[model samples]
Target: MDLRRLAVAAKPMHRTLHALPRPNCQDHAFLQMRRLATTDFSFLLPRRHAGLRSFSSTQSVPLSEVMPRDGSRADLKILPTDPDYLRLSVESMANMSRSEVSQFVFMMNSYGAVILSSSNRKEDRLAPYTMLDRLFGTPVPHDSMNEYGIVEINPANPTSINTANPIKEHLPHTDDAYTENPSMFCTLQCIQNAPSGGGETVLISGAELVAALSNKELKSLMTPGMVSLGRRPASDGSWLKVSSIPMFWVDKDSGWLQVRWRCNDGCVQSIDSAARPAYEQMDAVARHAIHQLVIPLVSGEVLIIDNRAIAHGRRSYEKGEPRIMWRKNYVGDGEIASELRNGLCPSYSSMFEGMWSMFEPKLVAV
Candidate 1:
């Protein structure tokens, strides 16, 4: 860890706790000989929910179809990139004065995420991913839109819910595992035209998901948790410290949110033991509470959901043709999050305290 960084982070952010919070409207891939071969239907899907229903589950709606997935055909089905979407471009936002920009960010921050669309491809500066990255640090690396695997919609693959491995889709989730200091926030720049299928990304408000759950369910989810990430075996025959983080942790002073969960390769095999219980809990409670997701999506439309307070996923693809999007994930900047943004990042000290605590038990006890 950056020691100079740690020195600055050790100080306590004592007075920053009272900052008012606000609300806002919100809101991967790879291939190497194909990570997923089309073999078993349950390849990495959940056994229970992975069982997609009929055409609704197996088939996806393609962009070419003027008919809705539900069988409603029309002369012109609305695409996510329709003229209405481009109207929300960042240039439109730029025309807003400084105060307006500040207010826009303030409103969006309070609400957790925002969306922007444009007719321009990735080059558009005001496009979804670029704007958010400029606002927040680059959160996480993911497959470029050019790399997103495209597929046709069929009933076999219903909603893009993860049953077995989450390492597949970068759902409308947070940037990292549970902690108060999340990365600067995640942004996805839509890149492909689905001609069909992949019409919308879906999300459930994390707060709403929690609110809708039963006490028994919530209790299990709130406990100190960890995640068991997987990786290659080491010389010692042990896998890498894939990662062990809680699903949720509010900062001691400031109430910023933090989270950690799996998407794609991170979700499968060789998970750390510490994270198992929490992962299981999340899966269970999240199962029933997930009905909160009914949001639709489209090309050029960007979806930014709070990883802390929301769970996100995608709609089924349009059969024979699929939509693709370029994704760049992010974590909120926690260390600089104090009301006094200029002060040292608290997480630095938090880091040393973490280091000292480990050895202090044995060193001091002596």
Candidate 2:
């Protein structure tokens, strides 16, 4: 075989290889061949290149269609009256059969949340964590706050602006939006219901919100670094951390829609001027009465929400009300966790690995 002729003839094959969608392990041999072919043909190239090009195997992957495989269509707007809401008795969690577990996982993926209630009126602080461990392995630690990872949501400091510490209504928001990767799931177990019949938990579907936005609005929101999330200054005038991030985006790999939102003034530090209109529009839709599911969690009930695809908050209660709850955030593990990992979306951490080093310092100063 004439080696030079073979190399020239393989030029067409190189274009075809580049056109292939993200390659699997089986395609590695072809990728290596392409690499070698490029090396062999380098002498034919001009000494002065017009622009630099990378031959690395890790070029950016094309954005996939943003449709979830778990039947959670972007257009399906969940309502308070939606019969498909996943609700199960606490007993089911304790003794879930394999098929039952599968159903539970399926519902969780489709609905972005699951509600578990017990008939007995008892206060078990450990029940929520216990059930979580049984179903999803282990809970994620709250490294900034405590060693035990469980956070007690109550009227601890009435004057504090932190939503979890005060009795005021928490507008719909994702927890830890400032961090590179917020928890994938979070659980809120009601130990004591609000006596004044307030404090219902509100959940808004991210998929539905995406479906409602106009193409222009969605594009603006999805632009990189269009929104910033961070903690406000402490009483002593010191900043914690800040992140310049996208408010909405689809993962290039899984094609799942991801959202990072903080409606609270304390966390939502800034929005780019161009994205402000779209951000405002999304906020309006998220807060609209029709788009929210108001779940009044009774005592002995635990609600698990997929933080990647749902935003959660609470209605206000009267000051000094004896309402208490246990909240735990989870990164996910085990079989159900595996399902979540492979599902349409994933935690934001994967998408912004170096975000803290790149943006945190500058944003904190601003």
Candidate 3:
């Protein structure tokens, strides 16, 4: 049976016994981050993957210490190169029950993308899905955060789909649904066919995007609601940029990371809020962030991402031949990890520290 089916079949729980190790400010004292000037033109893009849903399903499962069973860290560079920054782990993530895969996916989800080459082998994929079910829960929610678990078919009229603003209404988001965990990964396999812009997938990095912008623009872009002239998710009519979280946030416990800002021009939310003044403070940074990288996806392979750790979008295709890519997703534990650690550790935090003291308090012991 498919992992998704299995994860849902055996309703699992988030057992707290398997939590990730805590970071010591002394051992890994953060370095005040600053990007090189060249970082402006080519921003980082999201890795690509699925997401989790409702927190109720979490197993109280303790997040396990992140282990590198897949040795890609040294070899893998999060940037494009001649061989392509992509690597296929000799391991296949199929056939394992949802419980088994969750540990690995959870680890990878925290960092960025975990490439499963043999995932399609039918042996590796199932286990991970079940792991997700056992550790996080099942019936992963589909939202902008959890998108890609169910591939979104970009309309021929990119402008139209962009205009449709399907994400605003908060209806049936492409990837995540039911829960609000945001996506964890995207499992796609090429079916067949290639006619002009047929099945080329694209991706961008959230961390790299902000690094490209200036302090002024960065501050302004974080304005709330993501004002936009785009259509609301699943609804009609146009509104300005409207997003749930700021484009950027530096969780002291976890680290630095950018939320999903699938935003565009002429749309800016966050008109009235404490975050407003900060938004107005950044104009150039906002523009630089809006334009960033292209984590392109080719045929015969798939990419995964931690939606909370990153953001994702697709490329436009022509009509006639239908586009197809297999997709599935699951949720994670919760923000408790942030409370436990102070903040999440996305790639960006390594560069700069923000005024995140505002989020201080306590959770699982700082």
Residues 1-366, candidate 3: write the lDDT tens digits. Answer: 354443343222112211323222112121001111112111133312212221212322111112121222211113222113343443444344443344333334333554344435554323444433443334354343233244343332222334233222111112331122244434444433235543344433443444444444444444434322223342432442233544544444343443444433334333445434533433333334233224334444555555544444444444445544445554444322222111124323212223222222221112
Q: Name the lDDT value of residue 276 in candidate 2.
A: 78
lDDT score, candidate 2, position 359? 19
What order do candidates take by TM-score, descending?
A: 2, 3, 1
In order, candidate lDDTs are 0.35, 0.58, 0.35
Over 1-366, each residue of candidate 2 has an lDDT whose tens digit, in order, gives 565576587667656554454322123354345444322242333322211232112332212233222232222223324422456654444445575565556457546787876544353556455557766666676543345576666665321255444356777888768777677787888888888999888888775565555434554565557888876433433346777766665554444456777774556777888877767777787777777778888877788887777888888887777877777887676446656532224322222122212112122211
User: What's the lDDT for residue 76 in model 2?
Assistant: 25
Q: State the lDDT at 342 in candidate 1.
A: 16
**Candidate 1 local lDDT, 1-366, one digit each (tens):** 554443344222211221212111211011101112111112122222212231322233221221121111111111121222212344442233344345334323333444665444444434343345444444553221223221212223322223112223434344434233444445554555445444455544344333333322322333433344443321233443344444434344432233444433333443346444534544544444233344344555665544544455554443545454555555544322331111111111221121211111111111
What TM-score against the true fold does each predicted structure earn? Answer: 0.47, 0.66, 0.48
- Which candidate leads the pack in TM-score? 2
Q: Give the TM-score (vs. native) of candidate 2.
A: 0.66
Off by over 4 Å in 3: 1-84, 96-111, 119-139, 143-193, 215-244, 251-258, 265-300, 334-350, 353-366
Clashes of each: 65, 1, 116
> Which residue pairs does candidate 2 place in steric collision?
181-349
